[model samples]
Target: MADSNDSQPGAPVPCAACRGTGQVISNLGGSPSQVPCPWCEGSGTQIPGHDAQAARRAAAA
Candidate 1:
């Protein structure tokens, strides 16, 4: 296994549901079709410690 420092931690590598391509592939022969990454939600970057209360005041609000 690789170290956390070597690579970003808690970051969504790729939306398994949508794949790293960030699109809902369908009808292979279709002209064009694509969507955002469901896992990362198209952000491509996952915020660390999202579960934690980084902003408790906002959360409480």
Candidate 2:
């Protein structure tokens, strides 16, 4: 069966920072090395067409 996420006709692209893994390395000098990326909110993806800047502006508005 097709994956539900893949089945979406217009699913957002995988997040560049997290590369769709939904987590990034935290350089805060503590344990719990991985943290959810603020960009994709752990979803690990941005809107299909909008770049990161656009997405941020959109969110601000």
Which residue pairs show collisions in model 2? none
Model 2 residue 19 CA deviation (Å) reads 0.4
Query: What's the count of clashing pairs in each model shown?
Result: 1, 0
Per-candidate TM equals: 0.31, 0.53
The worst-scoring run of ten residues by lDDT in candidate 1 lies at 47-56
> Hey, what RMSD does candidate 1 come out at?
10.0
TM-score, predicted candidate 1 vs. hidden true structure: 0.31
Candidate 2 C-alpha error for residue 22, in Å = 0.7
Off by over 4 Å in 1: 1-9, 26-32, 44-61
Q: Which pairs clash in the backbone of model 1? A: 23-35
| Residue 45, candidate 2: alpha-carbon lDDT | 81
Cα lDDT tens digits, model 2, 1-61, are 8566555666567888889888888777666588777678788886454455665577679
Model 1 lDDT tens row, 1-61: 7665666655456445555555564354676656554345565544344432434345468
